[model samples]
Target: MSGRLSMCTICPGENEQIDAVIKIGRERRSVIYGTVIDENRDPVADAVVKLLQVCDNGRIIPLTHTFTDKYGQFLLGPLCPNQKYMLKIYKDNITIRYDPIDAECSDGDCIGNKCKRHDSGCK
Candidate 1:
């Protein structure tokens, strides 16, 4: 996609045409998919799953969010591979956070090497 802008801000009678080309390149994006489980290793349905971007200034920005299915499976996708991300899972009045999730994996599957196991409940 691309766009152009033409304006006459300084002078009313004089219209200036500024040729600005915005070339939107095709950036490689990946998905982060995983399952949500409880302490008993059981699927937790309807759990709120959030994908967040961790900025260098220690500010967290929410990218996307989704809820777990009946099987406790959730997928958040179309994410930029170059940025760092974190996962926040909320269930049963408790919030579980997983940091430094790799979104640049080939298949974007969190069940394998892309995901790291934390002390909080998550599979």
Candidate 2:
């Protein structure tokens, strides 16, 4: 009888450790959060506002709508990656606040074997 012998893929011959990589495509979404402030830089509560995405050509894209909480903190959800944004806050029947900032989604998810941490800042 003639036969050929081969090692199993899952088990590394019971002597060495095996490493596996599972690539996961993450959803490109981000949350916009910040404290609302007035012209005096004081926390403004209960402010109704809309988040607008800004373009390099001076165009405005309406993103989402939200209101500031008691602590002057607001969160707008699921923003597109690599976009600039400005918050339009209104009061006394007029637009009174604008804050322009750049935003981006998280690069990857924090999970699995890649979760090891070194002094280089990934923990």
Candidate 3:
């Protein structure tokens, strides 16, 4: 009768009282976390990572952004499962755009590479 009810319906009755409870299950969200490295495979700290969502009408919506830590590690999360997203990394006056990444709902981490070719190694 409390705590995140998905749906509730009540019916009238004559001289009668009743209590009904409805429950719904929640799906797990997706998270994208990875490290950003340079051509020499060195961690690129202070890099800007942007997560974008592209609409069918060719409109790009910026979902979230994060900066890499000293170890060039970044995390962007709680995203919708089974959805596609674009990752844009910026560092040292250079921009790297990766292809659309399909986010899956799982506990496993999604590791990607940030190289000169912008190959994210995401499927």
Candidate 4:
């Protein structure tokens, strides 16, 4: 927990001051980030990016989705680190599904993107 009192006791406003409290806790979440580009490495703006989770029984579940920006960049996450996920990109009437990407990492409380693409937007 964390917080602050705006005024000191010597301050006139402190006499009738209300109260405030703040609680802080760690949120275990991670992100998946990437960019969409064509064979020539040109950005594919407004491209659709889908996130899917595969169950142990071979069932595929649709998680969330986003679209690439003008720089072909997209971000999706705050996902569980123990799960496996795959990315699907759609643009120009074509869909490309990437292989399963493990959300796990070296840190037990791991978070952030494990896969990344280099582009102007990423910088």
- TM-score versus the correct structure, for each prediction: 0.52, 0.45, 0.52, 0.54
Worst 10 residues of 3 by lDDT: 1-10
lDDT per model, in order?
A: 0.77, 0.72, 0.80, 0.75
Name the best candidate (by TM-score): 4
Q: Candidate 2: which pairs clash?
A: none
Candidate 4 — what's its lDDT? 0.75
* Candidate 2 accuracy as lDDT: 0.72
The residue ranges of model 2 lying beyond 4 angstroms of the native Cα positions read: 1-27, 38-42, 93-123
Clashes of each: 0, 0, 0, 1
Residue range 1-123, candidate 4, lDDT tens digits: 122224434443745865656454565667877888999999999998999998888889999899999999998876787888888888886689989975533323225746443343321
Residue-level lDDT for 44 in candidate 2? 82
* List of clashing residue pairs for candidate 4: 30-78
Residue 95 lDDT, candidate 2, scale 0-100: 75
TM-score of 1: 0.52
Question: Tens-digit lDDT track for model 2 on 11-122?
Answer: 5766787787645455567777788787798888888789888999999988778888888888777777888988888655467688996765344536664543435443
